[model samples]
Target: MSAEAPARPVGSPRRPGVKMALLAFCMLVFSVDYNIVYVALPEIGREVGFSAQSLQWVVSAYSVGLGGALLLGGRAVDRLGARRMLVLALALYALASTAGGLATEPGLLVAARVVQGLGGALLFPATLSLINTGFEEGPVRNRAYAVWGTAGASGAIIGSLVGGLLTDYLGWAWVFFVNVPLCVLAVAGCYAWLAPDARSGDSRAFDVHGALLATAASTLLVYGLINGPEAGWSSARTLTTIAVGLVLGVAFFAVEAKAADPLAPPRLFGYRGLLTAMLIIFVFQGAINTLHYLFFIQLQDVLGYSPLEAGLAFLPMSAVAMLGSGKLLPAVVKRWGVRGALFSGLTGVGASMIVLSLTMSTDTGFLPLLPAVLLWGLFAGMIYPAMFMAAGSDAAPDEQGVASGLTQTSAQIGGAVGMALLIAVANAGLDLNEGAANSVGDVVDGLRLSALTGGIAAVAGAFLAFRIKPPRAARQDGSATEAPPEPETVHSA
Candidate 1:
């Protein structure tokens, strides 16, 4: 895959539709896995003897691994080949899921989740890269992204429901066990249908140092954030880990500036739209993830709802979101353009946040929560496609992998960071000395504050959505040129 890449051959029938669907299915699995653990966490703690304080690691560990390795995974797609990486990722996911299912201890489950996250990291970027290179730009690519976003969000929603059902009926282990069959199907599809990745002539060394530094920084920072609520924020352990994370973060940027082949190329950030979209995604995703996590905890702990009930509560919102993603978004984008769609979407999320903060209460029941949840889902569906389009709009064909990787990384990292902060806010009102004995009033107050914070963030994100502009994918001839299906070329200074 050199700069002077050969054009795609005429009359080659690679079944683009099937390929795209398979890739989207992979994204679905990744999204589902991330949320499945949320509903099952309490059950897991009871069975595995995990302390309440340490249980979050089961979730954050996966996020840390997945978010941290994303950029490197993107680079690997170009150097190692997307199809090959997808295969390896699927295999890793199957193994990790099995390990998690069989685990009897907290530590082992967390370790399995970390490995699973790494597999997802590889799959995430590679799958996106394949889409970027496979589809023709403009209508085709945009529609492909819509389907991709839909699959992912739907997966998250489905995971919520499925996790609850599996935990309630068969125990928490089935949530992990269920992934095996899905992974097997995905693996078979990839092997049978995915086209081989193009080979690049411009060979360069991988930036292992940059990758390690970035991963370490993210893991350490998240570790500190998640732990701060349990240990005092001013504790030596907390401060030390956060400080080390900051140092490593600075070091990562410095190294990237000088690296022969940086994990995140400086060129990719030159696109103003991409930068703005990434920011919007970071904040919006963070806010929503925080909201969902809080809602799950509130339902189970404060409201005393069973896991099955909590999961079922998400169905209406999920249905609305899926409808928006599959049906409404494309029409909105077509009629109002990307910016209009984005702003509209963010407005709903922001409004929901405000409504939730003001009206949500334990005694009011789930009725008070429905409007916000529905609004959040609607806005979320709108935001994902718009953000993804904006992020990759300005990227050259060769840069698509990193661009996609960067966006996904930002979203994941943002969600983790946001969740940490909100959890800390919720903990602030708790007398941990009381442990699980905290009063409903105390819990409700924490949730109200958390909702307020999230609402503010969502409003901020909505304002930022104005910065998004539609990608200029069409040519003067009124036809979109397909991106050359070639190995993304890498260069050294």
Candidate 2:
């Protein structure tokens, strides 16, 4: 065990249900915030003067910050304590939400998003660490993770609906404003149910160099990707930025190799299934985020759907996703194992994206989109929960926190890079010059290419999912230990 996490003391029973709920809520906020700003992009642009291309920053900024800090935050959770970090993250979330809601300019709004993403980065790893550590490893932990995954999927749907309602009825600002009360409630839940961290006897120094190198590498890479298409990809600035990012990435690994107290300790990567899990997560999350980003824009920009209608269109899919994650996934994992579940889910998601790519039309209504949406959700439910379980629990028990952060970091970085690539593909032949005449055909062309790119990525994820091996079951000597008793906290379905 690293000199960070200490074992829970004997006889102080934990409230597992309450713990799951609180952690799930935090996860919900992360997923919800990801897509909440999506539906409001049009409104946000109108009010704050964001061009179509410039609007990507509003979304990418958050991911860049979140991805960059996630690993470090996870280590902090191990060293600093999950409860303390989570409480602070929640407070930061509330403040960031307020700042975002009140922003009058594009820069301010993006800055606020960065802050919000940072909060999410810290909160995500801590929540997963807590869940992994708090629950005994078995069926109960699996179910808890499934519920947690369900909350995140459902939150994505809720975000779209909430964003639409608030944007249509109130204004775009309310989308950000709504998070304040919800975060406060989450903070309260943290205090009420979360167990205090058990401190290690030995103290370890923070790996500041590792953190800086990792963060700079990721940020530079994302910035280059996002900016590449806008400024000619062959331009010196774009090339130099990308090269610098690569160098930083090399430096980061080197730092990790020699550091006495590395942020991502070497032992964390020694686990069998972790590398495969992280790779699968990177591609899968990237594809899903790309789908959401383009689908929303396609609905509004091409089909001329109102925010409410577009949001409503996602309701059925969200419900299906929630059901799959909450109920169907646990059963599938039980029968097929984690790898089997992942393969099945990835196949569904990949097929859905491919079908959507082939079927998308300029003149179509909501009906054409329904089949793909439903398929994506159904598979996603299985994929998300299984992936989380595989990543968070497959590692040595002490390294669960690092595993959680690494998985999430892969997800955020993948989403950011995927969006950039798709955006670049979509915008290839379009006239994005300010005050230039634009046609709906140009937009449709971009959307079609973007869908195709996303489909290919998802299909690749399915292929990569095959690499994940099932976690090894812990061995027992002679007697089977009975599972821990459930706590008396209110349970979510």
Candidate 3:
């Protein structure tokens, strides 16, 4: 029962395709609620009597639970065994979904969502770690991570579409209930094909204090940020919550630096390109999450689109993204080194943001926005897969799970922060526009200004990518070569 640093030789030559699909499916299931619920909200609200402010709690709870606990989730996988955590989390997710879907009151539903997030936090990192267990580094792992990243990118479109249809034809409750069977199928598939491993000395000791402080701080901060839109930013509760969260976060860092078994290893920070990629991920993920909301609002309020229309508008992006990742990214990586491939892809993302910023008008149409969406699809396809490529390549086999989870944690935090900041800014501008312009068009203009903030964020991420180093596999000289099979899925894009 020692940790094996070796890659275990391509996993028995059984095609691997089916197992990878199951891994992707399981990981994506953890996230479906994040996007799907938005589509179901109106119907759920009508039945359950949730106020708008309270609805935000359902979303925030998920983000907080997942984002806050991701580091711990990674460690838990190492300690509790990936198979065990994944099984328990997936089953719990189904139960929680049922609770949320069947709840009689708004508060109960929100509580269900909180549990759902906790399950997701545990499940997602375990899924990625399982992929690491099954696949060797290099092309196999790259392809898997590409598929994995594609699942995450496409989840919004699929979830929204499924949510809308289920809400319209069946009932909003079906959105949650649908996951029950999916989870069952995923568990059966994983158990059949994937071998499970927990890190050596898993039960030696777990990072208990580190988990508590980190989770506490992240939950509070995420809670405050999300709630601040409804609760005034300057209010005592908001400010106090933020301050306390910051204090706890700082303490968590201090603990990590000193702890014998830290939830997040300080050593990972020393990896040449790891921190830089994390920054880019943090910014990009936040901004990307807001896109669904922004598009939803714009399509409905300004373009006279319906709930389904708003959901459908993203189809092009999803299709293009699938094409780019499934086809373009691998070709690009095979041709270009990871550095060139990622740099080029991220540049494409930045350009897409510019195009989006220009056409984010009250009057813009689907046709005018086509180029932007397509470019985003193309680049984000490349960017996300590369993130896994870079991080995993940068670390040891033992570190892949933690690395993957850390990258994911950064994304969740980014999404939460982006949602909060954009909401606050948009609300502020809308108020100002209401005072001065006195029209729907004018208020829409104000919303555009707020969205411009997101564009700025993408630009910043692109700049951040400049500092991200290529993994040893992609490195030109003897110094940068990664130890075998470790370069596929842990780092940022």
Candidate 4:
């Protein structure tokens, strides 16, 4: 494999529609895998003999693995070909899922999940890079992203539902077993449909030091954030871990500055809308994940809904989100542009959160939650694809993988931070030490406070959305143009 391969005829795939569908399907599989385990965690703990505290490793291990490997995966996608990386990622998923399904102990299942997450790190960047590089910018790429976003949103909701059904009827193992066939199909489809990588003779060296630093920083940072709430925010262990991660992050940047071939070139940050896009994604992801966490707690703890019922409760919002992604997002982007669409979406999400704060109560039924749920879905559809579109807006074809990686990294970190902070806020004034039960009123109040905080964060994200400037050609001529040559050095955006 070579670093500078001749570009493989960008935007010229045969049966592009089918290719887009396959890519979207891959996204769906990853999304489903992410959430499906949540509903099965209790079953997994009981069967695998996991203690209450250690059971969280089942989820945190995956997060740590995905967060750590994303930069490396993205670099690989650019160095190797998207099709090759996609096949490799899907194969990993298939193998890991099988291992997970057959695991008789907690350690094996957790290890399998970590491998699955590493696979996701590769799959996400590869899928997004293919979309960005395969379709022409503007309407074609926007639509492709919308379809991809629809799959992601729908798959998440479906995961919860499927997990509940599988865990109850078939067993928790089925949750892992299910991914095997889907991954195999995706791998087969990739071989049959995706074009081969362009041949290259250039053999630029890989940035080993930069990759190691970035991976270590990401993994440690995510680990600390995920455990901070449980370990106490001011705890020495959590603070020390986060501090070390930050130090490593700074070291990674310094190494990148000097590397012959940096894993993540600093120049990528100079693209017009890229940094702002990353910021918006960070905030948007944080807000969305916090909202989901709060609602999950509310539905099950406050409203006394069963796992299956709680899963069913999300259907309306998921349906609307999918509908908006498929039908409304393109039109919104066409009329208002990416910035406007993001602004509108973030604002809507904020308003929805505030409304949820006011409406949710122990005495209330699901009907009162509908207004906020529908509002979140309608706007979230716009935000999901718009942020990615913005990130890819002026990125060169060869850099799409790393560009996608940067935003995805932001998303992972943001989700962790948001969950940690908001969950802490939600648990305020409540004694959660070793089985202390909170009253319904106290829980409701905490939920309201957390939702309010999430709403404020979303509004801040909407303001940041305006910071995304139009692409250079669009601003100059009011028309889109192809991306310019990559800059020789990093420059201020």
For candidate 3, give the lDDT: 0.73
Expressed as tens digits, the lDDT of each residue in 1-493 for candidate 4 is 2325433345346798998999999999998999888888888999998998889888888888898889889988988878899999999999999999999998998899999999999999999989877875557778899999999888977898899999999999999999999998998888887887776665998888998999999999999998887787799999999999999999999999988899998887776577888888788888888898888788998888887788888878887888778878888888778888889889999999999999989889899999999999888876888888888776777778888888888888998998888888888868898888888999999999999999988897798877666444455642232456322101112
**Best candidate per lDDT, number?**
4
Q: Considering TM-score, which of the candidate structures 1 and 2 is the better prediction for this target?
A: 1
**What would the per-residue lDDT of candidate 1 be over residues 1-493, giving only the tens digit for each residue?**
4535534422112687887788889989887887788779888999998997888788878877787677777777767888888888888889999999999998899899989988988898777777766775556666888888888878877898989888989999999999889999998988788766566676687888998897788777767766676677899998999899889989988999999889877766767667877888888877888788777777877788887788888777777787677777888887877777777787777788778878767786898888888887877876787777777666666676678778877887677677778777777878777546877888888888988888877777777766654433322322222333233212100
Best-to-worst ranking by TM-score:
4, 1, 3, 2
Candidate 1 residue spans exceeding 4 A from truth: 1-13, 427-430, 435-438, 470-493
Model 2, which residues run further than 4 Å from truth? 1-13, 427-446, 471-493
Please report how far candidate 3 places residue 348 from its true position, in Å. 2.9
Taken over the whole model, the C-alpha lDDT of each candidate is 0.77, 0.78, 0.73, 0.85
Sort by lDDT, top down from the best: 4, 2, 1, 3
User: What are the TM-scores, per candidate, against the unseen true structure?
Assistant: 0.90, 0.89, 0.90, 0.94
Q: Give lDDT tens digits, candidate 3, residues 1-493.
A: 1233433432322658887887788767865766788777778878889886577666777777777777777777766777778887888888998888789898888788888888887787677766666776567867887788778667766887898899999998888898888888877876787665434554457778888998888788877877776777899999998899899999999999999878888878776556656776777776667665666676777787877777778778877877777777887777765656667776677577667667877677778878878888777777877766666556665566677777877777777788778766666645443246545676566556656777776765676655655444445444343444333333222
Better of 1 and 4 by TM-score: 4
Q: Please say which candidate is ahead in TM-score: 3 or 4.
A: 4
Give the range of the ten consecutive residues with the poorest summed lDDT in model 4.
Answer: 484-493
User: Cα RMSD to native, each candidate?
Assistant: 4.8, 5.3, 4.0, 4.5
Clashes of 4: 0
Q: Which residue pairs of candidate 2 clash?
A: none
